[model samples]
Target chain A: MRRPDHQTTTLTAEAVLAPYLREQAASFLRGLRLQREHSAPADAGTQRADEAARALRHAARRISGTLHTFRGALEPVWADQLRAELAWLSGTLAREHAYATRLGRLLDALHQLSGASLPAARPPSGEGASETDKERAALGVGAARAGALLERRLTLARTRAHSAALQALGSSRFHAVADAVALLASEVPLSPSAAEPAGLVLHAPAELAEQRMLDAVAALPPDEAVEPYNEAHDALWHQARQLLRLHRYAHELLRGAPDPALVGPGHALDLHRDAAEAAAAASAAARTPRIAPATAYALGVLHADQRHEVEAARGVFRETWPHAAAVTAS
Target chain B: MRRPDHQTTTLTAEAVLAPYLREQAASFLRGLRLQREHSAPADAGTQRADEAARALRHAARRISGTLHTFRGALEPVWADQLRAELAWLSGTLAREHAYATRLGRLLDALHQLSGASLPAARPPSGEGASETDKERAALGVGAARAGALLERRLTLARTRAHSAALQALGSSRFHAVADAVALLASEVPLSPSAAEPAGLVLHAPAELAEQRMLDAVAALPPDEAVEPYNEAHDALWHQARQLLRLHRYAHELLRGAPDPALVGPGHALDLHRDAAEAAAAASAAARTPRIAPATAYALGVLHADQRHEVEAARGVFRETWPHAAAVTAS
Candidate 1:
């Protein structure tokens, strides 16, 4: 009787699968980035260039954050690869020689290119120049020679920085990050629509019926706990009878010449024997413990009152009352 | 000079440790639930008893969902445990006998004690009997029976539904749906006053001053292609300069008692030597086959405007141009 449609089933399957797919896509993209070249310099000026590198580093950090957050959404198989790529990038940035060079070169260039020229002579008398001027002049000449020596060093540092940045761009990390962004962009729009299928399948009329029963029970006075319990108990009994009837109906429908595989080995035969035994047991149990009206009311009160002994009351109902009813009816 | 504070380090360590700890806690809680008596039903009237059982099952389902979402945010390690618990619950619910008997017994007891008796026999047609009376009698018995059966079946069905819900609560899936929520719940928040010792050490002005010479040359724009070969050449040269400066600074700081072990052995020493060589080579390269300033400017323009042959321009800059003015000054 509870026939779920294929669409509902498929939707459930998709819901289960979506996370895996997303993770896979993200990892693949990260790997692709690591294998490619895509570093963007911040600016042309030395100060700005350093700023640019800093900005790029900041960007890398942001990407790592995004990857971390998105890691869960990705498929399990893909998550490992993505995590590896992200970890590499983060580690590289933390201690990369090239990054150090780039930052250093930018700072050095800014210092050199942003000031007025000084003559290689005695300290000139200027408003800002004094005893420190003589000291600074000597330092400047020494610094100039040192700067010349450092020129070769600066060139190397710039080269290394550029190389590292390029290497990072070319790595798989880039592609994975890109892919994740794309997936997020595409899939987000479809979420509202995609939710409909699962909603439809899980929508059962039984929920409304159960709700009504609960509301009726809840409306009873707090002191009249037994009444609520009785109502709830009767409601549940009614539900059991309905299930039994439905099970019987299903059994009847499938009884004749059922496929051996469908029923399993001797399962059908066992079921018939079990049914008879259950009926007899029910009749026998019904004979010994007849539930008086007062006891039922008391049980209901205990249940409604949320008594600690509610479980004991339920046990009495389950073990005693069903058998009594069957014996009395027979 | 680069002294990182203990508190910052500790916080960073805590950030890394939080997820693992939370995952362990969730796993332990779930294990507690799986233990026999913790989640078992209490005895009571069949109907009220069924309600209690249903309530317990619902509670378990809620707990499972919480654990699952927690696993996604805090730790992937517990994913297996969460999955296993859900699978077990699902398999149990799929079987009819598991929940049906317990529900049925509870319901039967309620009916016997409620004093809501059914008619024993059909009466002959009488003056009081109308079409509605016959309809009520026919429907009443059937309705009561259906209600009893439904009570038991609904609990099982709902449990199954809950299992399905749990299966669908994948980490990636939930994150994709609500990333901010996941981060807030899972990510360890850094205090506003948390010390950034690493940042302080790296950005120290004194450290920047010591490396000013190398920094200047690095600011030079590349004149050749930005391909890996050229980039690597530039990067190697840049790294050489940075290494040289760092070595010199370290030597100055350590004085004569510099630790050879700190300098590293074999390949690391060779790398330091090679970096020096590379820096020298980049400087030598900068002196020859220099691109005309106009050409260098044109390349810069192309990179900024057309974004074409940017790599080639970078290559030219690396090959020509004695370290840029910025490197010497900054």
Candidate 2:
């Protein structure tokens, strides 16, 4: 599939995707170099290098997958064009591995020179020079030779210009792989919540998110009760919403869309059945509100000092104190 | 000078300074250990170790200078207390260095083991039967050996928790020396615009600091012009202020009060004279408005279409047009 020249186009996805890929690749390569330099020679060094290589490969695969996905979404002609481009990229990667092998040799040579005593022996010069002069001249020659070799290799590859393309492919592949891996690694069994049958239940990996929710609730000031408590409640609601979104996305990807039969024969035909049920439940919950102690204290303060309705405020205080105490103990 | 209590009653200055000195010592020792392990040959390794030692000594001297500065600020009795604590710290550093030499030898032995191929001998009695088990067993042995040696040393120095103190002192010293060396090595001549007119300038070696500033600026939104420009202006103001503070502090230490003669006449009474001048300049620059095409277009869109203030919006557009054109041309 190839995109028609006349098709409405903003920024080409490749234009955005290319630089992003290249940056990720460059960062990964730099990290690899640093690890190679700093890590002590041990089984750990080998293990670390293997892990890094695995990560790089995973990243490359992700980029390839993303390109494929984008191609699938494009018009038939454009899809074919993108697929062809990806095919070319895969071919280039094969050749690039050869270049990497040569680069490895160059690196090894550089490492050797670094380890060698400074003022290395002069390359066979016919001149009868003093030892000091010979040493100084040799040092200059060795440095120049290294620089020239590196420059020639770089020029051969047109590395400065082509690096961007290499980077883009690598990064996209990485992200695709990472996303797939995360999906596969998730262990929680999906289920429907009892309180809200329409809502998908999530078993949190740990109590950390829940603990943060509790702390936020406890930290609310007595004087500014409702707003603070509501903010925390909202935060928890959002966290729950995120879990729902993830569950929906995962379910869609894994098992296609929701089955109409699950909601019952007639219910599936009703377009707003799920929405109406959810809203009704929410409104009922809102009517029978759970008041917390901080809420009570805030109401008390408002009544006593801020000249709010005394009897109404006292009623709210009495209702909320038990929940507030329970929340504080937790 | 000995503190009267001998064990306690030292000033807060001495407490802070003692830890700083100890950290410097510990850092120096760690660097020495790293050098000994990494350096290829005995002679070269010794030279590197000696260099690290020299750096530690230089840091120790700086700590002594700071102590003297503290002494000048405190009462005579407190000054005596600080001096005693400083002397004890300096003595501790010397002793710590001796222990570090022994530690370096052990590290060197471990470094050799990392590079060595395992001997094709029968597995030791404690070695495991399975391949995975053997690996685990070897690791356990290595850990046990290291731990035992460390514990033995700690036990021997149980009199005053001398081993822990020494280790802490060595680590601290190494860090201080490394930091000072980094500062000295990386220092670059500040641009005239960034330089302070008077007072000590604490800089993170110009290249690193400049890179950090540039990174921060680059991370800002391209259209959000206020923050990037303001940050540069603020940093200059901050630098000037710091210099002024240091000058005042130094002057206070040197003399009972700031010297009017050194500062000069009426205008010199203000310690932050340079910083105030820079801040005023920055403030004036910020207030000096620049009209851009985008700004004019945004204003026109907001007032003309949204607010329906055609006449007022036209006036603004006309006023800004020339400056906008000038900006575009540039």
Candidate 3:
């Protein structure tokens, strides 16, 4: 929603938040319409469907984040129920993309290392071309099988996710959520605090969100102390990513736009989360029962690469923390 | 370009490629119109502008790629000149996005690690919350200034790129290329070789492209031997990516779509290129004269993060090469 030209200090919480809630709810309905009209329910899916899903997710996230961050200014019971429903919808929709991205990343890795374009094995020579040919031949072994294995496993997972998502969208639970959001578009369930000036009422809650995010980031083990590809640290960073997002949403509530200070870090944390999840996917694929040793080896390498990405993101966070701290101080 | 269902064997080279080239050229013109009409040249860009830029880039790339891959099937002089012009336009337009992405990545890294949301400082303690607060304060020092430095540098670069893109779009060179492409849509510049059946003449060239890609891959030193984050190796991988793209375009010319075999590797190579370039950007940022030590430290970490991403992508490509080889052999 566009920000009011007048100062936020003069506005009521209802004035600031009601329009946003209504807009997101309306957006959700529009997304649903676009998705249904553009694609067959039983079909594999299309770019239009994907775009609709993204719109739905974006609206759902903003709504969910708003409810969570601004809970103190809303009717508690209603807010909690709606927040839970939004989370359910968001989680269901996210699964397919997660599986798809992981599969793409793994398959791409396999394709890059494979020599499907190269000739069959040639005699090794001292020159550059020969060395490449030898390496290509060595690495090409069992690559097709590996690709097939990953494709089969991940595709199944993605198809399942898609079905689950479709089912969820059509279910009574989703309809109820939609009904509630539709009602929200007409009337937000505000508490006594909503009567206060928007700026004054919202400041503490936003601050709390920031404090939580900071606490989470600070609690992480120093980069050097953590083992390379440490799962425990990875989990913490994922949690930190969520906290940062909450802080960002809260910041948006306060200022009308997402805090510029947090936007960059929020994006970096997103990359961290994706890398961690992808690494986990590779690890899972590697654990497939009685897979070929070469397939396993390739999966292992894929896993390691993602893990390094995780560490790299963490290093960036470590470097960036000071700027965030300085912003807080100011 | 919707694919024609009939077997490619019956089609002549001109019969197959002329329509595709025409569609891409029209698409390019449409993108240019969308860009010009949607926003004022003097204003900071909008989402519409970005979308237009992407459309333009896509069309330019497809045209250039097709020209290179299908050179033997067309008038060589006409094709080469057009290809060169398309490359120039693509590169010029690419600079703004590149700088923007680099800036976003660096800034996000800084934001994620900063303590902008935390309290200024706290006494150190063994407990989790206390540990977090202490760490947040430590990391926040000079982060704001570092962010400022990077923002200034990258934003300047992006602005310059934007201007260059705009100037290129308006230049006579671009107009000449556009005119040639417009004429091409009606009358394809054909060579005597174009008389051959599409499948007959295209095979060897596509095969040759693949062979060159494979040879490049074959030329690289063994993975273990090439030290991690090796620049020379990164450059080689970049070249391999181009060669792979040429083969992919060649394949698409023969078949109706891109080789499924190469798509996955192509995406991985794209990531490799982006990461390598981002790493270079960070290194350059770190080298800014008279910057604070803390600012330099943050940039160094950012540089390291991107370098690791580069290596990670390389690892994926390594694991993927065999699949490419398998497809090539078959």
RMSD to truth, every model: 42.2, 29.9, 23.2
- Provide the interface RMSD of candidate 2 in angstroms, 1 decimal place: 33.3
> Can you tell me the CAPRI class of model 1?
incorrect
Give candidate 3's error at residue A74 in angstroms. 0.7
After TM-score superposition, the amount by which residue B216's alpha carbon in candidate 3 deviates from its true location, in angstroms, is: 18
Residues A1-330 of candidate 3: C-alpha lDDT, one tens digit per residue: 435424567998877877778888899888877866764655445788888888988888888989988898889899999999999988998888788888887677667556454433232333435434433443455356667888898899998998898898789998999899889978899999898988777767777888888888888777542234345355567778888888777666666677666666777788787877776666565556666544544454455456666776777777666544535512
The true-versus-predicted C-alpha distance at residue A36 of model 1, in Å, is 7.4
By summed lDDT, the worst window of 10 consecutive residues in model 3 chain A runs over A117-126
Better of 2 and 3 by TM-score: 3
All models: lDDT?
A: 0.33, 0.32, 0.70
Model 1 regions more than 4 Å off: A1-60, A67-81, A90-131, A149-151, A164-330, B1-330
Give the share of true interchain contacts found in each model: 0.00, 0.00, 0.00
lDDT of 3 by residue, B1-330 (tens): 435534556887777778778878888888878876764665446888889888988888888888887888889999999999888888988888889987887677667556444333232333434433433343345356667987899899998988888788789998897798788767788788787787677666777888888888887657642234344356577788888887776666666687666766788899988887776665555446565544544453455456666766877877766643635522
Which ten contiguous residues of candidate 2 chain A have the minimum total lDDT? A300-309
Error (Å) of candidate 3 at residue B53 is: 63
The DockQ figures for the candidates are 0.01, 0.02, 0.01
Per-residue lDDT of candidate 1, residues A1-330 (tens digit): 222334334564225324333443454344334333223443322454444444444434433333333233334344445446655654554343343443343234323311223322222234223423432332233234333433444455456655665676566765565555456434521223334443332222222322333343243223322322122232233333323332222222122121222222123222322222222221121122332222211111111122212322333323332222222101
For candidate 3, what is the recovered fraction of reference interface contacts? 0.00
